[model samples]
Target: MKIGLYFGTFNPIHIGHLTIANHLAEHSDLDQVWFVVTPQSPFKKKSTLLDDHQRLEMVYRATKDYTKLRPSDIEFGLKQPNYTIDTLTYLEEKFPEYEFSLIMGEDNLKSFHKWKNYELILNNHNIYVYPRLSKGKIETQFNDHPKIHHVDAPIMELSSTFIRKSIKAGKNIRPMLPEHVWEYVDEMNFYK
Candidate 1:
């Protein structure tokens, strides 16, 4: 199976997140798109993040109906401040038959070289980068990389940060999130 790994905190799985996964599954060569919910990110603040289990549940709820998409708890047991290279190595060992690709935003690509073992990641796995609303252009160095493919996945300029802010402000965020996710958030009174 060819799986595209879309990693994020998912603070709460929203429509924008789903849109990219859906687009990749439908338009790309991938057979499955796994949303690998990050428990903690080295680049993000831990205080602003919700409980890992709750965030994972939201991803499961949001993707339950999509056959091509599935929620992954792969990072839950991994060490904190998870790095992409380590996850990729573990996944390859466990699922030897599966071909894994990295799915990321253009903004992330701008700083791809800074990631740990970035060269190894590019050498072993294909990177499907989608356009994002960013201030910088993708570096020319990545233009000729055979493993890198530029995908037209819609970058909804929507961030979990923005959604969380809206929820705290007592605004209706239903349109921005998956119905199941919104319901779970409402029921739990999350972000308030």
Candidate 2:
């Protein structure tokens, strides 16, 4: 199986996340796209993040309808400050038959060098980068790389931060999330 790992905090899964994953799964060579819910990203601040289980559940609810999309809690059990390289290595060993690729945005590629063992990741796996709304574009250095495939996915401006802020401000976020997810958020009173 050729799997594309789309890792994120998913502070709450929204339409933008789903659109990108759907586009990649349909257009790319990937057989499935796994939404790896990161409990705490090594580079991101942890203060504003929701509980790991909450985030995972949101992802599960948001992606449950897509046959090609899967929600994963793999990072939840990993070491604190979960590193992509370690997670990738473990997945490779555990699922030897599956070839894993990375799905990220052009924004992340801009600071790709800052990640741990980034070079090893580039050497061992393929990277499927999608366009982001604010990010300028992918750098020229990786634009032509054989291992890097730039996808022309729709640019969605919706973000989890924006959704959380809107919710706190008593604004409607129904347009940005799936119906089930919106109901789940309301029922759980999350992001309050």
Candidate 3:
């Protein structure tokens, strides 16, 4: 089985996240799209992050109805500031029966070279990159680098950061998130 790993902090799982996953599962050949909830990302700011388990649970709740979209807490057991290469390697070794691929936005392509063991990840895994701003392209050195998989979900400018800011300010975010996600965020008092 082919699986696409859609890694994110999921600070608060929002509609854009769901839309991307839904589009990937609906259009791609992959069997499943797992939202791998990152405990901490090596490249992102750490101060504003929500609790790992809380974020994971929110993701799980938000995606419960979509059989094809599942939330993964694999990074919870891994080292702090988890890296993509490490997670991919671990998943590959742990689940040898499934072929794992990386799912990311086009913006990452420009900075992907900076990632640790980037070559190893490229050589080992297939990449499904969704089109984002300017639709970034790659000039890969490794023989089997990330392949671009154009996704056609609605172009959303709102990000988790933006959503968090709005929540903290007590601004209405009704349209930015799913109903279940909004309820969970409110119940948890996240970003407050």
Candidate 4:
């Protein structure tokens, strides 16, 4: 199976996330798109970021109905401040039968060269880049890289930070989230 790993903290999984993941799963050659819930870095004290499981639950609720999308908690057991290359290596060893690729935004692609062992990652795995309204120039080396595939997916400007701030301000941000995810966030009183 070919899986595109979509990594995020997903403090609260929202529509933007679902849209991109679903689009990639349906439009690209990928068999499935896994929402890899990134665990919070132990060194960073972020109160707004929900517990790993809580965020995972939100992801679960958001993607439950999508056949091509699933939630992954693989990073939760890894060392804190884990790098993508490390996770990719781990996943490759664990699931040797499957081909894994990365699903990232254009902005992330711009800073791709700075990542640890980026050359190794580029050589080993494919990177699916989606459009994002972000500032910065992409590295010239990646402009026509064979390993990187530019996916003409919709631009999602919505962010978890915006949702959190809206909820704290007593705004009804229900429309921004999936129905089940909204219920879960509301019930837990998260970001309020």
Candidate achieving the largest TM-score: 1
lDDT per residue for candidate 4 within 68-96, as digits (tens), equals 99999999999878999999999999999
lDDT of 3 by residue, 21-133 (tens): 88888888888999999888766777888888888888988899999999999988998766888898889889999999888777776677888997788777787877655
Cα deviation of 66, candidate 1, in Å: 0.2
lDDT for model 4? 0.91
Q: Name the runs in model 4 displaced over 4 angstroms.
A: 41-45, 134-139
| Clash count of each predicted structure | 0, 0, 0, 0
What candidate 3 gets wrong by more than 4 Å, as runs, is 135-146
Candidate-wise lDDT, in order: 0.92, 0.90, 0.82, 0.91
Write model 1 residue lDDT over 166-189, tens digit each, in one string. 999999999999999999999999
> Whose TM-score is higher: candidate 3's or candidate 4's?
4
**Model 1 segments beyond 4 Å from truth?**
135-137
Clashing pairs in 1: none
> Candidate 2 local accuracy as lDDT?
0.90
Better of 1 and 4 by TM-score: 1
lDDT of 2 at 91: 96
Error of 3 at 124 (Å): 1.7
